[model samples]
Target: MNEGIGTTGMAGNDHYRMTVDLNVLDHLGINLYSNIAAVLTEAVANAWDADAENVEIGIDPDGKFIEIKDDGIGMSIEDMNTKYLRVGYRRRDEDQETGRTTAKGRPVMGRKGLGKLSLFSIANTIEVHSAKNGESHGLRMTIDGIHKSVQDKEPFYSPEKLPREEIQVTNGTAILLKDIKRQRLGRGATALRKRLARRFSVVGEAHGFKILIDGHPISTADRGDLPMVQFLWSFGDEEPDLSSAGQLLEREALSDRLDAWDGDWSVTGWIGTARLPKQLDSDDAGNLNSIVVFARGRLFHENILDKLNDGRLYTKYLTGQIEADFLDADDEPDIATSDRQRVQEDDPRYVQLIAFLRKQLTQVEKRWTEWRRLHEVEKAKETSPALAEWLESLPEGFRKSAETLIAKLSALPVDQDEDRKLMYRHGILAFERMKLRGSAEELAAHVHDIDKLLAILADRDSLEASLYRDIVKSRLDAIKDFQGIADDNAKESVLQKYLFDHLWLLDPAWERATASEVMETRLTTDGVLTQDMTEKERLGRVDIAYRTMAGKHIIVELKRVKRKMKLLELQEQGQTYVDKLKKILLAQGDATPNIEVVFVLGEPIDEEGSNPERLKSSMAAISPGSRIVHYDSLIRGAQEAYSEFLKKSKQLDKLERIVDRI
Candidate 1:
């Protein structure tokens, strides 16, 4: 059989063994790592491989250069030759005998034999210098699109090897990517600092590694320093010791490793977010997720996310990393990779591992759901004082985000039935904060600001209508509350006019998500929603009691009033209100409601009862389940309830007259 071909393989057959084009790393070298901080992530990963205690990456965007230096076990010439110097050649497992990995209890993270290729992805050249065991080596290589050019001789495919260079330090790894790609600043990019902060923040101060991007040191990731086996069910390392199957085996197998700080973790868990359409959540190249599987503190598998398509690891809401320290970086013989980047199904050990993972995933699912519920409560707490007072005070950024949150809440569609989008949106904030709880690291990234909200409203993500409405609603809430504070009739008139214009004044009280059957009765082509005889919804006059999930008063409206309508003849409006109250009693769900209603006028400005006949007929035409009342009656009732409104209006008028005289 040909070494390159498997069993009569055709050129297109995936079975054909082929190396990934140096172009992958080549593309990544300059394009993917174009941002200074992104390139630093690679350097940080490498430093972890070197068992570095500290690493720093710096950039001079104007100078167009980047430098990364690390204090780690620097490389010997032979080590450099077999590893760094030889592309695709790695003796990582063999190096275990050298005892570099054990002290850290983690093997090196670079195995693909090709990550260094990424250096060239962003820069034209990479200069490297290092020393170890009293020996030193330094070298430099230029990409020059060498990976792209094919040679007429020598078969045209070989990785470059740099021999030696002038050295300075006794023992350390320093790399400079000259002619580096970075975000331009000033007229070019004022955002370099922020983008850098986002990228290397994961390479935080954890374990022994301390990394910095540009001038700012990386902050700890939420889960940084989380022990490998904290709170996990433990089983002793007698892998073959379990003598039975089922629950008994599970219980018996979860014994702790003798020296495992918290005991060797035996349970492995998988948790995922729900699947949505590609339009909503794309997994395409542009949106590809890289599942970094760390073994011995190195990325053994970079894009394993594509493999977990069993619909488990790829959930949009799912967050976590697949972890196992003992599993070899090479998941082969025992595990295999298909041309599709999927895991081999028949691999027994891999299957066993996954099966074990699935079981643990069950626990993980439970944990995540618990996390989700708590998350929802936390988010709800942000809005409601009861929930707010229950939770601890938030950090500065969160407190500062109150207005944004109000805007978000205002734009939300009535939470009718199950509003998945609202839940998901709030879930994002909740999950983020929940993870941040007790996290020593302040969030390094920018909080979603008011502009971001406006941008989102402008871009119209799935929350387009609601987000926009929320923004308007937030402003309304602020003004209305203030209007009530003044308790003046003039202010009340302003508030009333605002509510009429927004139409959200009719929203369910308590701000609980609500639903209404909107029937449009346009007298013109403009398509105004009105109460017409066309009668799409079968509604009758009744009480509009609506209990709120959020506490507040429910407001209901009878679409429009008719001039000759008998029910709201101003004389009968109160009785009609009582009748509607009786009607709302019948349409009960599990939800008992808090409700109110208004008889709107067809000719709102009409005199002699504000278009009485039409109003009466419309009020009479009210849905039987609805709690309804006359528009005129409501105004009268409100004024009666708050006589202060009338007094304040008179006072304001007097004050205006006095000021005019002055």
Candidate 2:
């Protein structure tokens, strides 16, 4: 059952089961340590384990060193050599199994061992000093930049921390890193500080610690600066996650909620924020793209972000602390490593802990959504000016066209651009706006503005609107109103009203109110359904012919029918006409013009309440000459409306015909 689950590029001698990869380490140093907060996290983790009450960090951009000092129980010379020097040493489990619990019997915090390597990712050289067990000492470590200076060579050696530079330390640990790498500061460094503060909320307790960067102290609480935080579940006293092989044997006591072996230390520190400021740039993170992971006073993964299978929708908002104290060696059944270092996810204990993390995250997000609604309003001022302006200018065609569009836009309010996956690449939203991506409707409203601008250039607004009625607006409005009506009879009533009063608003071609000419459409042989489409309705009308010899032909086809089913039988009637016409025209050798089809229902059938399966099942055949109308609305009484006294006659005549036909 025990199988290898990590990196497979084992390059050292064959016998060395835990051989280190110099290439990976070198890559990790350059690629992973890309953030200021991550580097600070490593330093703070050390402080937490040392029983440090406070930790302070100072960043000096011009100077070479970034110093972090903590008031923790310092290290002795022997602990440094045996423990600190050994890479991949799994000793936390033994410590926890025996001496894992704190004075309060709380499980430990440090696990998953690889924190310090990330420091090398940021700085080439580091210096350390610790005063613990009533003794004080200082030690220095150099990354040997000269060797790493080569073009792609992975050296076999590790970071060098020698005794030559050692001095007896007092009651704390102070470390300094030289040649620092910053992810993104100066631009949004303050944001990163807040991020760090939000992620490590567990620190600064017991012997509370303080973390500083560039001489600025990170805020201990970000619930104020953050958008919304919803509590899903909090960690309570529990056993640690452990593994013999790989098959997880969960415990029996907890509720069916989710089983987590590790006891809760501090799962606090998550911060969910509203849509960010518009000026989001890659340069914002500087070099760090992800948060760092720690295990047993050591480093595990740096720049480890939400990847495939991570499956958390709001994972970008996931900034917090994960406690792994139970994995210590002193705990029963052992939760950690041989070195009391880090938690292994393969270890059944860690998996159970992750399940708990996933569950808790779901809760946080659920509550966060409610919180998002309330606080998201305050940040409206932070909306991108370009975005805000674009949305404001949406319906700018001829005075008629633009206003019509605006009216429609107002109905479906959108304030965010949720899906920005291809926005930048497609040049829809520039990279700047994309970086600060929000809800989709908000972005669509901006795109709608661009369409208006294009309309203005086309002089479509030449048509004046005495009553603010643009044909496009009228048409769009008609669709909305049509979609709103529940009954077909009410729809007939609305259409009759269109004949007189709103007649002028319609296109000149459709303005004439007459039941005299019936438009006949035909779709025939060349109808080929797309192979990729599996559903039957995917086999749709290949052609539609709107025959109007006197006025313009406005071809309308029922492409969408959410209320009824697609009447494929209607297409049969259309096909017969098309075949007869083609033969007649072919025999006479007469030239025929092409007519574009406007799906009565639209091409993208709306999403809110569409059941493609049901729609597909409803496409039965129909007879020739029978009209298949997608939308039909009538104005109450166009020019004849003033004659309300003759309501009975009017109803008997045009109204009866319309009602019976419908």
Candidate 3:
């Protein structure tokens, strides 16, 4: 087959030689594109270069083939031999009369002329048919045949002639690709339309060009993100018709020109941010978090957004296009790489373009943040009237800080509106507290500091009622655990461990404190308190510990749950702790000290002669600020105190209901 096709001419008595190294096809063709969409872009670009008004693409997934037909100025026999088949053909260099544009006055997209070879990347067999000026011709090329020619060390390979009946088009060109590589067609027809729509800016009637995928003409709507655009900014004379952007378009900024190098270069096109970043994500079309760059209406770089290195929070939601035709000017050096997916980074034109885009991105980020804040504020106002009243009640300076805080919360990547509303509620609470305390300036300065903002919201006085409510809820849960342990008849040591860890159970006001470790160590040391205990007292003792909180030293004594003791015995132990702690403090140069002791026992004191009330009074007189609390009362008292706080905090109840509504 190799020898049979090696000598065949393209047409009757029309000998055409494809003079080139067969090895170059590997880099320029077979390895050029990895997907059907990328390969079809080259075909569409070729059609654009041919001044085709309408390019139709047909997908035949079942038939394992694709047909791209273009009603353009198709190549004649000699034009094919010299331009179509010739590798490294520089159309711009040869067509000096027409210059950089076609006869129809559209800038030509084909430069290196290697786009024709990209066809071989997807299909094993290719058939080309064209008609021009009352002449029709056809040729067929195969991967196997090209390989055979390469193996045979042939200088040139000729494509086999196609029968006249195979030339279906009478005024344009038709390319049929057979034996397609599997999974190259992408997700589906709709996905293909969107992908193609995003790649070219000239796929509309305004440019005298149109692309039809499976009989459906590609339109700007296929880009899929226009309706989701919340804010848009355009550069250059042409402002895109954003009416289709719908009600979501909150703002649009237009500029007449984007100049670089003293007007030696210029750019046009618009950058837009979606209402939500997820709006730009798709399983079919992939992430649209990119700023596509085009030159002469063809995609020059897939995404310069990454190259810009703008790591602002707003960049994730950005997707747009910039047309810098100067990147491909005939007067300047070609800056595009071989695949045209990127430009040479060091090129002066690209550097200046990056600079210009960075400036534009900065402006867009500023507007995007403000617009997002305004939008969130309106939504928040609509959700809760109380929140609206709260916002309006703030002074000018405080209101701005509150708005920024709410906006930052809204910008979180959380998906649910309820979660964002909850965050906004807490943010407002924190802001109000800060405002009351004259910390409005501090709130404004650290608006973006999430940790500091959280700290403010969690502060005890930020929303005192709400903070206490949360604390009450948590304490109730702990109380339940303590009751379960008592009901289970756990060991005395187990009960002691639970009580020591949760000192608040004994007294609602007591909390773990940052007491001096040295003082605590000295008080709990063996010689300090152990020397005072009798052998029988030591047998029943589980733990005796010291904690300082609320500016008072507290000593907690945990006794065996089964042990029974009198109020006189409890008063003696309490007095010992008080005297010992005072002496320790005096030895360290302190004269006076505040101290309290808590005795947690499983049973009440065994009073013999007098009633329980008389015993309690005598014990209180003996140990001043000390008390004997049974384990059951300890848990019950903690629960009742918190439950009572929850019941009485009417303001927090109202705030919680408002937040839930939001």
Off by over 4 Å in 3: 1-20, 61-63, 254-260, 436-661
Candidate 1: list runs displaced more than 4 Å. 1-42, 76-79, 93-96, 99-106, 133-137, 145-168, 182-206, 222-293, 299-317, 326-662
Q: Estimated TM-score per prediction?
A: 0.40, 0.42, 0.68
lDDT of 3 by residue, 357-424 (tens): 88777778888878877887787678677778777777776787777667666666779877777777
lDDT (tens digit, per residue) of candidate 2 on 374-451: 333223213334333333443333222222222223222233443221221222222112223322233332433566
The TM-score-based order of candidates, best leading, equals 3, 2, 1
Instruction: Please list all clashing residue pairs in model 3, or write none if there are none.
Output: none
Per-candidate RMSD, Å: 18.3, 20.2, 15.4
Ranking by lDDT: 3, 1, 2
Compare candidates 1 and 2 on TM-score and give the better one: 2
- Report the lDDT tens digits of candidate 1 across residue range 284-304: 112212333434443334444
